[model samples]
Target: MSFQGYLKTIKEKTGKGPEDFQALATEKGFVRDGQLQVKATEVTNWLKADFELGHGHAMAIYALLKGLKDQHSQ
Candidate 1:
């Protein structure tokens, strides 16, 4: 699936968008001021355990959290 597809699915499943996740990540100390303070594995692990996301899907969210734009945006 495309990156946006993954993001869409994640929003459907989690009821949260990238901005929402960023807020939660900040609350969890995973991010600070829109920057990732933890390792990708740590973020992936959190997503896996809490959101039940697979690696690729979790990575898609991770990419967004790290300030990467969707390919379609380019």
Candidate 2:
């Protein structure tokens, strides 16, 4: 699936958008001042445990957190 597709599906499943995830990450200290403070594995692990997201979906969120992918991308 495309990046946007993945994000849309995630939102449909979790009722959360990238901004919401970012806020959650911030609360968890995974992100600080718009920068990711943890490794991708740590972020993915948290997503998996809390969100029940699959590996790929978790990675998509990780990409967003790390600035590797943009939430507004086409």
Candidate 3:
């Protein structure tokens, strides 16, 4: 699936968008000052455990957190 497709699916499933995830990540200390402070593995692990997301799907969010918005823009 395309990046936007993944994002759409994630939002559909979680009822949360990038901003919401960003806020949650900040609350969890995975991000600081809009930058990711944790490793990709850590982010993916959290997504897996809490959101039941697969690796690829989790990586999409990770990419967004890491400021790769160009690809996410669709």
Q: Candidate 1 local accuracy as lDDT? A: 0.84
Which candidate gets the maximum lDDT versus the true structure?
Answer: 2
lDDT of 1 by residue, 21-70 (tens): 88888999998876889888998999999999899989987887777765
Instruction: Quote the lDDT for 32 in model 3.
Output: 91
The positional error of residue 23 in candidate 3, measured at the CA in angstroms, is: 0.3
Give candidate 1's total backbone clashes.
Answer: 0
Error of 2 at 2 (Å): 0.4
State the weakest 10-residue window (summed lDDT) of model 2: 65-74
Query: After superposing candidate 3, which stretches have Cα over 4 Å from the reference?
Result: 70-72
For candidate 2, the lDDT comes to 0.94
Residues 1-74 of candidate 3: C-alpha lDDT, one tens digit per residue: 88999999899988988888899999999999878999999999999999988899899999999998634487
Top-TM-score structure, candidate number: 2
Consecutive 10-residue window with the lowest summed lDDT within model 1 = 65-74
Please give the CA lDDT of all the candidate structures.
Answer: 0.84, 0.94, 0.89
TM-score of 2: 0.95
Whose TM-score is higher: candidate 1's or candidate 3's? 3
TM-scores of the models, in the order given:
0.87, 0.95, 0.92
